[model samples]
Target: MKTSPLEQTRFWQAQALGDIEMLHARYVQQRFAPHVHEGYVITIIESGAQRFWHRGSEHLAPVGSMVLINPDELHTGAKAHEQGWRYRGYYPDTERITGVLDELELKRCGLPIFDASVIQDPQLARAFSGLHCSAEHDASALEQQTAWREAVLMLVQRHARVRGTPLPGHEPGAVARAKELLDSLLACPPSLEQLAAEVGLSPFHFARVFRQATGLPPHAWLKQRRLGRAREMLRQDCPPLTVAFALGFSDQSHLNRQFKQAYGVTPGEYRRACSGH
Candidate 1:
């Protein structure tokens, strides 16, 4: 039961947004012990078969199928075939999934509890898989957000139900003020506590309100804003290093990484493309 080198298990940190986590893994002999995650788990099985225990029963997820696990649900996983199983997965916190529900204007009957453990729809499988790929890679913020929203909407409309607490209320007023601060202080952004204090809220409440309003945590929002300004500056033929300092990025490389993550091209490449040179 030793895993071969080809049997990869990669954990991807949420690079674009703080609300999601991802994995692209292939397992030959590895078996997961019973565990629970505090968020929703949507997995697309790529090959072979995976057997898992959930909700007091066992389920099989074959290739080209999607597995949906609700928040805090217990589950286990093991290969059912000799060839093993490959999958790309996303773990989005309750707030994140609910934000999508809010955007879709779905009135909250409750939390989204999936009725099906394994879904075989090719279209949904493809959509979820594509979202995973975008999230796990250096996909641009707009690209990643679009995919995330689409996938969540499909999952909720087709497979999940509202059977928990009602959704949160309106975006707080402090959130608006905090956003203004971030916009005004791009070159020297305020810390969470500092922003919270100026907005007359605690750090925790400020962060929650901000995320509930924008679908991204405060720091992630700042990064996105920085990237947006950097794109504009880069297109205007601003030097990469100069754009970095102007936008509060630490340096040229930092700017480059963020630029590439959002646009799928480096600053230099983007500038040339913009110039038609």
Candidate 2:
């Protein structure tokens, strides 16, 4: 359940930007420790089954199903069946989504894990696959972004009715403070003490309360965001050292270490794989 500061930033940031790391678990026992994120989590169960504990409920997401988690909600995930599961997820920021909704003249909506009769529709499935392709390939940047947004918006409209309040148990104002402070430092990451002070919580209490509200420890969650963004930049063919610098690492070497540590491969390897070199 422990993750380095660098990894924390990578994970959450990636989700904020619509970059998802595909996950396929087979007979696995992994805990999605408690913490909140700054983005939405959209997942599709491609095969097998999984259990999602969210908003004080357990959802069994089976094959050919989709799950959407609103920003800053407390949730946990793991395999629900013996054969385990395979799934893909997208993490998109609420702020960005709201902007799109405004453009489309749709009201802002809550994070919804909608169950739809049409989700299994062949047309919708094809659209979903195409949108997910945009997440993986670079060819249709604008087209895919638009398509992805539309797909999500429609899903929200169909299934997500406003439910409870926003998450992390902190006043919305206080939680926003934490996000602001975190945004300022993913590289040379801050100490928990400093972060807690910024968010107006004692460190120990912050860890417990924040996780209960968000589903991950503050630090571990943040690293995932940073790693996600770092990967996107690297995919852009930016110099590895530059990617490190932009994301707030000590240097390329430091970035490489953390990148490999979190991703199970070197930065060069990641870039090469992404570029299909």
Give the TM-score comparing model 2 with the true structure, all chains together.
Answer: 0.53
Q: Write down the lDDT of every candidate, Cα atoms only.
A: 0.77, 0.60
Worst 10 residues of 1 by lDDT: 257-266
User: How do the predictions measure up, each by TM-score?
Assistant: 0.58, 0.53
lDDT string, candidate 1, 1-277, tens digits: 2436657765545556553656687887667655556578888999999999988799999999889998756677888878899998877779888888887787887688988889888988898888777766678988888887887788788887778573454447798788788988999999999999999988998888888776668887777777767766876888899999998988888877656433334678666645545
Q: Least accurate stretch of 10 residues (summed lDDT) in model 2?
A: 7-16
Tens digit of per-residue lDDT, candidate 2, span 205-225: 877776665456777667666
lDDT accuracy of residue 100 in candidate 1: 81
Residue pairs in collision within model 1 = 111-164, 140-262
Clashes of each: 2, 29
Q: What is the lDDT, from 0 to 100, of the residue 97 in candidate 1?
A: 89
